[model samples]
Target: MLSLLLVALLAGSGAIGVAAANDAEREDKPGGAATSQGPRNRSAFSNPSGNLSFARQLDFKLGDGVFRKLWVAAPSSTRSSDGLGPLFNARACQACHLKDGRGRPPGPEEQPSSLLFALARPDGSPDPVYGKQLQTFAIQGFAAEASVQISHKPRVITLADGLRVTLQQPQYELRELAYGPIDPTTTLSPRIAPPMIGVGLLELIPEADILARADPDDKDGDGIRGRAHMVASPTNNGRQMLGRFGWKANTASIADQSATAFLNDMGLSTPLFRDGFGDCTAAQSACRAAPDGADDDGMEVPQKLFDLTVFYARNLAVPAREGIGAPAVRRGQKLFSDIGCAACHVPRQVTGASEELPELANQVIWPYTDLLLHDMGDELADPGTPGDSRDGRLWRTPPLWGLGLTRRVNDHDFLLHDGRADGVLQAILWHGGEAAKARDRVIALRKVDRDALLAFLESL
Candidate 1:
């Protein structure tokens, strides 16, 4: 039965093609034509798509400039860079996503820039006082919303071979409240900045293909029920579209994600989120009265600059896989599929057509995510919202394309939505609900097989 399942998975992953050698070679380039054959260092995630035209190279560079550009308080002589914050988290996109990689949780004494807290009431409305997110930074003369502190409680799990793995259960506390006391019913969700590789390609994945894999009712009785997160398209005139980005799969497109980050993280106005006083509530009159950095068009980030930034985000390339054909990696790969990890982290997806970005269109990519929401069980659940049916238990399956390079790119191996897991193994162990069986299988694996499984993930 296990052998049959392995064969079925291999066939589904296109690993059993007529030209097996050719297929193996193709797997090494997980991003297809867009994969960056790399310098293989800290700058690995910073490259443009491999197939991007030379003519468009300058545009990508300009977009990088916009992403790394720092913001300041309004009324400054640097007209283009002003409009920072009444209350915000980071000054630039790069501040959180340093080197275009993952964001780490801040140390005990450090103030958070990349790890942010999102606040929502039971009915999916912003907190009445602190607004949608908690901002730790404020412009001069303004009180910041709050100070965030994280502490961990140790949890040790003994595996089948009696190998004990310790996991840190993170605890978040808000201190130094600036505005007022938060409503007791508000739910706080901590989010780490996810890596920004192959996002454009993810956007190009056909909605039909994604929905085709969703088993919301679990009709097959596999206990893995992935559901599509339907959200209103911010740019498509309120058209409901598949939600593919963010920890909760709340945002629908790369453009929307970029615009949202500009507003919430940096307190800069974008075309999508037009409010210059980002995250400041109506109750906070002082924040609302603060001066903004809007230009003649009444926007902080103008259309041209916003377009460049979004383009840069969309074009960031996925690095090519390293050491894919090694004996351990091959074993690990087979084990990964056999253990049911691929049920949600479906390995292969072909991007749909895109005339505007031809290089990304119709390419086979290995993002290792079904891009659907799943019940992650109680351990990882955020505080429940009263009227929300999901009750904060469902989380989007983040892509695993750049799983191996976390240490090189960010100098840390913080994983998962809250950066609670210290490594790949810990992240997997934390899985529950639909992934509970897979997690148990991993725990039951012999040490060698477990190591092989991790090796396969790292080769991704």
Candidate 2:
């Protein structure tokens, strides 16, 4: 995931242009200083496995025997499929996430339907018009389930001196629903495709590594405590698990997450997800007209496709940093530690046995997150929605590895639950809940210090 973001951000300027950092100006900043931390500890974010460039071996990994060999074959797109949906967003997984990857946020100059997220739920029901994902396309001969519209709501931010600035939010609109309106209390959170890199390793990180860092009560009075958020498996298997994917932190594993993407995002399916009934409402007969599952061209092929996808995402490497080379970046790293940003965005971790792949076993990865959940307080809470074992506002501390690459990958720097910020700087400004202390410290820093800290994040 971090590596994907880094590529996107680094290559972003091509479509637009990266605002070059003024090295001299950065060096002059007081807080963005250099320190002799002596070749800082190796960042675990980098892929500890070997090279991970794109390759046919990565693209294909067919297995043995017709049954177990499902582990090596690709799930072919069939005319009438097993895991597809009567209601779905795209025809292929590569559509929204281009290359089984990241996407550009919808915005000015971008195709109206090129980007999709911000789904709408009517007054009381959980279903969405274009089936739950606010879809833009439809199967041949079928009318699109619904369309999406956007509006803006502005709120005032008051300064210490009473100066106020308006913050405008791009509101989501659901054009049509097959059933009733969403409950007045219903809330929404927009999500998009995140990188598929390193997820396997992330899942492999021992649960103890996660719990050892939990301090939900803020025992030290640092006011920054973290917890874990476990959501229902949705495989509907009655198993609740630590959420490892999605902005809402809802998915449990690459397999489940991948199956969801296949069913919800694209109208595809695998043996795992037999049908596309996810967003289908009981009232939508057409959407549910198919059998329990979709096509079967590759129903048996999921094992292989999923494993490689797992291998790719799990072992994709993090770019090696030459050690916060600049003085300002170094100071920013220290400030990051001193201020407790590291508390939740913990710096490092080692991967466990892959049992599946020998190559990824016992690897050390620096992902910058403990993969736990935390309450971000009211300022960031999505009211009306209660969370898991934690509160509604809690979110997994996202890994910071390739955060700097947001602009490149998605073409915009929207961050948080609904793309609330445009850059790391703005995202930091929006932090609350357990990390409020760290957020306050960031605001209190002088221009130089703030820049240094940001430099540190950028350097990540």
Candidate 3:
């Protein structure tokens, strides 16, 4: 808890900045911690004042060897299984996730909805928002490559004084058709890759608290009840555990998260994800002829590769909080707690014991999330593959550190689970399902009050 609180203050270059403002695309929500707007963007601040050096000591900082391994732009291959992906996104983990820690939208100007989560139905049809992440280049005779970039549509909406805020929706488009049409029915959806700091801390939280935060039965009668989403914890072997990572809380651990990313992002296979090959539906022919991860004999490549990649993701540092000493940001911090954002986005959490990283053991931390799933409302729904109950309208509340530098890190600034907004503000605007009331309350605030809210978010 102490480490987390200190991280909130601006210490030095090691620390990150506090806040910034948003444009019209964020009209639905407010701006940063400091602004010409309302309430001085002040909010109450709560942080743990533990020894910073001690916390860092416990951190599993990735070594140069592992970090270097990840930056290769090519995956490692074993004797039997060659680094695969006749059908994949990029050659290495850092391709789309650049710098190993940030996600940005792709448009002339960064907008929400930029980071993309790619997937196809069992038969290879494009999901609505995500046209087709279909792989273009396979092995030698494989397909060309799936198109992955964003396109935009311009729009004009005039305000009361005839001040027109022209904006672009920031849409993703696939180019250079490779093989056949996507199955008319494949469900497609894109989500930004979240930063890796504090994730290990999140993974260590006792599931009891996570599940305890849920009210799946809505017994609270707040119409905003949230519940836990259960998924397989890669660390738990075949055992299923409380889902924690990913937009939909679909993945269970850093390793599972890495495995999914390697296979889907690069078409590489690991022991956990033995097959990099995808099932080709009738509509997509290239997929039919694709190369798969072959374990012909032993499994050395996948084993070592997954281990290092997992280390890289698991050890990344949570950006240090810089410039948090500003008076306005502090005020905005108070307002943040006054509002219920802290309810679902629960502020302080302590990690369970850990053998791998002693620094991770029993130390309290501030992750600002309940690690539960909430229904969010129709305004934000992508209907992205709708079988899971809590998740169809829900998303795990992503951590808020390092946001000020998302652009610097990932080179873009699209927020939200599915990249629905141009900035953090739009992500707030899209909060409608169980959060409709909270959103409406935020929208009703006067101009200054709204700016204050936005400030608080930027401070995150």
Tens-digit lDDT track of model 3 for 1-460: 7654554342211121231121112211111111112121111111111222434423323322433332211233443335555555555554455565555554464322225445555443444432335443455555654556666566554433344444455455655656545445554566666665566667778788677778988887877577787776656685877888877787788888777666665555567755545323335445544545445532323565556556545544454454454566655555565555666766556567777745455644556678777887755555454324323567777777556556555556667765546676556656777777666566555656656766756655
TM-score of 2: 0.73
* Candidate 1 per-residue lDDT over residues 1-460, each given as its tens digit: 8766665566455343222234677778878999986767899999999999998989999999999998999989999999998789999999999899999999889988889888888788888998888899888989888898788899999999999999999888888888889999887788899999999999999999899889999999999999998888777776889999988888899998888888888888988888899878899998888999999998999999999999999999999987988989888888887798888888888899999999899998888898999998999897743223345889988999989999989999999998999999999999998899999999999999999999988877
Give candidate 1 regions above 4 Å deviation: 1-22, 384-390
**Where's the lowest-lDDT run of ten residues in candidate 3?**
40-49
Best model per lDDT: 1
- Looking at model 1, residue 409 earns an lDDT score of 91
Cα error, residue 235 of model 3, in Å, equals 4.1
Which tens-of-lDDT digit does each residue in 137-256 have in candidate 2?
555444555555656677664533344445546666656643445444445545555544356667777766666767778787876666665677755584887776765566777677
Estimated TM-score for each candidate: 0.95, 0.73, 0.73
Off by over 4 Å in 2: 1-84, 98-104, 108-125, 128-133, 153-167, 178-180, 183-185, 231-240, 276-278, 290-301, 383-390
- Tell me the lDDT of model 2 at 382: 55
